[model samples]
Target: EAGVTQSPTHLIKTRGQQVTLRCSPISGHTSVYWYQQALGLGLQFLLWYDEGEERNRGNFPPRFSGRQFPNYSSELNVNALELEDSALYLCASVPTGYSNQPQHFGDGTRLSIL
Candidate 1:
């Protein structure tokens, strides 16, 4: 089974821009989660989507959002991106009906603000 993979590996942007990140979950997984690992943010859960619908979201602003495709792949969208937003975006996954399982992590898409 293929493990999770993230695109762009790294991204750089100025403040007040938009950024999009992608992720592909492992085979047979039905849920995907997004987490932001900023210097002070630690590993904060950004969003969770399952079966093509959003299941949960963290305390982040409305600018942080994402969606899951039918194939279980996912994308994260951030608008009006700020310098503080610069962080490593990680994607995680779990099998359907197994929320208790620790999620497998991607190498993460590093976002930088210039």
Candidate 2:
């Protein structure tokens, strides 16, 4: 069984530039989630999408958004990026409709703001 995978291992951007992170969940998974891990701060949940619909979102602003595709993959988009947004964006997924299922995380995309 393959685990989650993220693309563009690294990204460099300026303070107002937008960035999009992609993720492919393990086969057969239908629930996808996004998270942000800053240098000093630990992981923080960003968004949650299941079966192609957004189920929940973290405390982040509207600029932090994402969507799930028909194939169960997901894309996280951060607009008007700020220096504080520099961090590793991680994507995780789990089998849908199972409350006890554990989420599997992706390698993460490191976004650096200049």
Query: 18-113 in candidate 2: lDDT tens per residue?
Result: 888999999999999898999888999899899999988989999988888999999999999999999999999999945368889999999999
Residue pairs with backbone overlap in model 1: none
**Stretches > 4 Å off in candidate 2:** 97-100
Clashes (candidate 2): 0
Q: How close is candidate 2 to the true structure, as a TM-score?
A: 0.95
Error of 1 at 16 (Å): 1.3
Candidate 1 Cα outliers beyond 4 Å, as residue runs? none
Tens-digit per-residue lDDT, 12-90, candidate 1: 9999999999999999889998999999758998999888999999999999988899899999999998888989999
